[model samples]
Target: MPALLDIERGFAAALRTGDCTMAAELIAPAGVSAGDAITIYRNTFVSGAVKALKLSHPAVERLTGAEFFDSAASAFVAASPPSSGCLDDYGAEFAGFLRLYEPLLDLPYVAGVARVDWAVNLALHADDAKPLDPGEFDVAARIPPERLVLVPHPSLSLLRLYYPGDVIWRAVLERDESALAALELRGGPFFVLVWRNADGVQVGRVSEAGFAFLSALCAGRTFGESFDAAPSPELPVLLAECLAAGRFTDFREI
Candidate 1:
């Protein structure tokens, strides 16, 4: 009989490739043949992953329809299995896969929609953090803007895309055909801001200036450096809104 490690490796390969030859060599057939058992294992494994993918990317599934989504997800599972043990950590690459997926090449916005789904899913699962208190903001207020570095809330993320992903995602989820119809698919690079609070996960579009300002802060830039990076005249109003939105957990003045 082969060693335990080698058998396990073979079993994993069989699960991925749908060939039981290596694992079958060691197994005696019972009521179910070794090949059949391996087949069951593979199907069960792939199906669970497909379901997880569907959950993480409901917009993608809704946009594509179950039949098509299942087929594409199955292919993705075969091509890219989960690396992390956590289900929440899976399917981060599905959006990229959809972009290159042959059948989806013409419908490129589908991938953008997947990105919105991924972003929102991530926000929903982010670690809990208290928003910066009004007092805290007041303390940081005394510091010169050049010396202030803001810590983003755990759930805040920026996803910039070539298509208006958030609009499409909302339109599809809400079944708002009029909004979808009015969308100019070619009018992109859209910047999407995703974050979570007591109200729940929020997804919305931000002007390029707002995205740049928030993006700079998220990257650990000081107010001065961030403004230099974005150089927007609306920087003051954007900063006030960021404070009101509770997008930060902390801040420090250097």
Candidate 2:
């Protein structure tokens, strides 16, 4: 029998190329013809990859139509197979891929929308934590500027797009709304923050300043330093609201 790694590599290559004959050469002889069984695997691989792509880029599919989206997914799968066993982690590079994809040129916002979808997925799968209590507010506030730190939820992600991509994403996902009428991209160069709050994962509009501020906090900047970087007069009020709303997720004192 072929070495396990060699067999796996050949099988993956065959799945990529639809080379059933090559795949058949590697399989153990069994009750069924190796070619037919290999074909099953090929189809299964395509289906799984396509499903991951669909989950990660649902907004793109909604924007482009399933037919076009499937084609793009297939092309992308053939070009770049999953490097990780965790299917949920697949398609991280899809946004970058769409940026250079010629067929999607007309839909400049597709990649950004895909990014939001991926972020939501990450948030859903992130580790759960107890939210900060009301009394901790004093502690969070009292931490000296230099000693303040933020422990962000694993699911939090910030996205900026040149189109109304987040709006488009919401319309597509919310079943109660008729998305077609609300599909126009507007208020461009949009910035958004997404995280699990008192409820489930929520997406909301944020200013560039807000995005930068949260990003800095998420990256471990102290309260004073992050505020210096953000430097917004209203930041105190917004920070309070975010904390009260369970938006901070976690933190540590420096």
Candidate 3:
């Protein structure tokens, strides 16, 4: 008999690639051929991945329909299997995969919608943090702007999409046909913010400047540098709004 580790590796390779020759030699099944058993395992794993993708990218699945979504998701599973055992953490690359997927190239917004879905899912699952106290913001506000760096809440994320993905995500998930119909097909440089506050995960549109500023902060830029990244007259007002909304948990003096 092959060593246990070697047998396990061979079986995994068979499941991933569907080339069961080595596994057939290593795994001696009594009733079913090793190749056939490996095929069953592979199919089951693919089905589980498809289900995970459906959960993560509901908007994409809705837009593409069930059969087509299943086909594409299966292909994705073959091309990019989960890195970990957690299915909930799978399919992070599904949006980018959709963008590169030949069949989905015509409907570009589908990928954008997938991005929105993934972002919301990420925020919902993100570890919770205590919201910044209003008093902390008040103290940070007293510090010289250049010396402070805002520490974003764990759930903060920003996306700049070339389509109105947020609208598509909401409409499809809500099953609002009229909202979908009213959306203009014109291309966009839409900016969206996804974060989990005390209430729950939330998504909202943001101005270009606000996106630039907050993204800079999220990337660990100093407050002064954020203003440099986004040179807007409304920086003060933007900071106030973020503080009010509990966008940051703390501020660091750099």
- lDDT per residue for candidate 2 within 63-105, as digits (tens), equals 7899988888888888888988988889988887887789988
Off-target runs (Cα >4 Å) in candidate 3 are none
TM-score of 2: 0.88
Q: Using lDDT as the measure, which candidate wins?
A: 1
Q: Using lDDT as the measure, what is the rank order of every candidate, best first? A: 1, 3, 2
User: Using TM-score as the measure, which candidate wins?
Assistant: 1
Per-residue alpha-carbon lDDT of candidate 1 for residues 33-66, written as tens digits (9 for 90 to 100): 8989889989999999999999999888999999
lDDT of each: 0.89, 0.80, 0.87
Residue pairs of candidate 3 with colliding backbone atoms: none
* Predicted structure 1: lDDT: 0.89
Regions more than 4 Å wrong, model 1: none
What's model 1's lDDT at 105?
94
List candidate 2 segments past 4 Å from native: 27-34, 175-186
